[model samples]
Target: MSTTGAPPRPGPRPQGPQDAGYGYDVERLDPRGPGRMGAAGPQRRRRRRPWARWALFGLSFLALAGGAVLLYVFVILPLGFGTSLVAFTAALLPVAIVLGAVWWVDRYTPQPRVSLIYAFIWGAVGSVALTFVIGTPFTAWISPSEPDQVTAQFLGAAIQAPVVEETMKSAGLIGLLIWGRRYIAGPIDGVVYAALIAGGFAFTENILYFGNSFHQAQAAGEVAGFWQTFFLRGVLSPFAHASFTALCGLGLGIAAERRSLMLYFGLGVGGLSLGMILHALWNGSSFFLPVDPANPLGGFLRYYLTVQVPIFLILVAIVLFLRWRERRILRRQLAEYGRAGWFAPAEVDMLVKLGARRKAEKWASRHGAVARMGMRDLIRATVELGMERHSVLHGKPSERTRRRERELLERITTDRRLIGALTAPVVRR
Candidate 1:
């Protein structure tokens, strides 16, 4: 972990670096090696070929670009830009809703914005493109020579769609786990990232469905089909994809904590399988449910109420539990620093409690913009510090983590000085 010179004490100032008058040695707080750079620092050297990594990056960029081109040509061009624009506009509603839900869950220890954007783009573009490439052939291979429309739709939605789409979406989660492992501390982070990717996928998929419906309805001189599709997908089941993929994220998050490769793979595969099963179940239900000619959605509504609603509720409860676990970890980890005099107990309470933190920010905002910015930085650094300490307490310690801790502590120190308006929050019990 990182430690810095404590704030000035009431008595005389400490004489040396080791004795900053906190009653504890700053060096002792961080058992890791010092990062002080002397005058004669080592010179930078150019590295030799990192060809494999660069090749992978290039290939990925090319693949996504190709996918975008295919999407524009095959999907968007067929619908025409005007129709696609209308679909895109309608799709934004559900995207905003999912994003808001993810943001609320990710309020504590938020992941990097760049990483979140990558996940979203991969879900929207890369996964959709992969689905086009793999799903078309696979569906053709499985379909009978003389296929009926109903059978083909069932095969595509219940079997092929679930298998293909979930696999493609899960790939984004796997990539994040492999490349952005440091950002994923636990299941909450996994769920949040997975939800973002699923959200993006849902957004793109909605545009296609919405566009198709609108075009068909326009040709028939009726808006019923388009409105019906929107009601089903947009109003009722906006989070369906997110719910399914979050299972995979939950698994990958648990996988992140494990050192064993087999265990990690096992858990990840398990989560993906669960997500696929739920997706298939959801898609297949429409087929099994009896549809009345007068009331088309009678059975569908019953299934949604009985099955899908419960599953969504259970997922919500699990997320709440995970968030509570995060709060517990923050309290446990920061309490050690609080005891060491690096943080006041009230400050720790403020960091863990969103209500208290909000109040503090509101207070800082009354002072000035600088004070507001400083308060935000202070809260963020404090959260990161707790997470860093938690990482060290677990078996994943490294020098890089220590360096990050030092950097975060330095940030916290600077922010605390700037945020002089709010020292310790008067948190409610």
Candidate 2:
């Protein structure tokens, strides 16, 4: 919007009389008035926001994306080749899809594009590269050193993997906050972003593991172990990254939001340490301190997720409750702005409830698709605009912030008028 300068205006000139001088009033410029100022200079080129600053996102995506492909091709392909590639691909589908969705959602805001791109790269590339180098030896060292042959595999499966994998998986989330500080928000964002990266890593890794399972089945001359492991990894473990990464995210998020530097560091570091402990406990849960000499740990592989699953669920419950609280706080904040006449009471009510918002959009849809979409946008924009108003009440918003808010509401509310409906007129001065 600042790309164009308004047209110059003529001012009245005054000559002083001997006895008294008269002051002249010059009309102030009206930005929206149809004329040179409105239509000619700033409007023609209509420069977009400094979205150009984020154009680098495209390049980051390309560079990191190629790396993901190469890793998958060389590492994952070999692992799956011995068995059935189809099973690997099938198991990978959900993880891959969820990762992409998370990536897309993070883009909706003017977030630090590099931070997000790095998050993906850190997980898919950095974390993977670390684990491949670190995990191979742990496997070899532990392989022959199991409990009674009956429980040896469980020790390697439970204790070995969690200690090995969770540390590797958590590195990306930590790297993101340390190196890419611009994008990290509260615990919620930390979880979501970390989970995305972890999920992406897990998905790619799962394909390889599943593929190897198939290959091992071929070696054993068994058909069922491949599918059974495939089902377990594909269905059960795709969400594992999301769960584990969320713990780290929660820690980073708490630290990010804290005003006190000491407290922030302490809380965040504590949370991350807790996450590591959780990972160890989860991995080792399969074999508790063994009561039987035949079993190194008591429970074995069956309890790895089962033990951690409840903790993950509790974390999820806490996250949901926190999110609901945020939504309600936002709703209450916006409803107060309705008192200023910018929004109608009905509109505020609809914005506060998901169901009310949906019904309002559905009602608007009978007129036209564009109208319905516009109304939906209007409601959302109004809520956001009201929030911006609160920020403005406290301090001056930059021109870009103001322009963006105006543009969003204009696009939405304008469509509502064109559809022969008006939700509410602008508030009176």
> How do the residues 69-178 of candidate 1 rate in per-residue lDDT, one tens digit apiece?
88889878889988999899989999999999999999877887767877788888999988988998999988999899999999999989989999999898877666
**What lDDT tens digits, residue by residue, belong to model 2 across residues 223-310?**
7877766665665555666676677677776666443456556766676566656665655543454455565334434464566567
Quote the RMSD, in angstroms, for model 1.
Answer: 7.6
- TM per prediction: 0.82, 0.63
Judge candidate 1 at residue 40 and give its lDDT: 22
Q: Which stretches of candidate 2 lie over 4 Å from their true place?
A: 1-53, 80-84, 93-126, 133-186, 235-238, 255-264, 286-298, 301-306, 364-369, 379-429
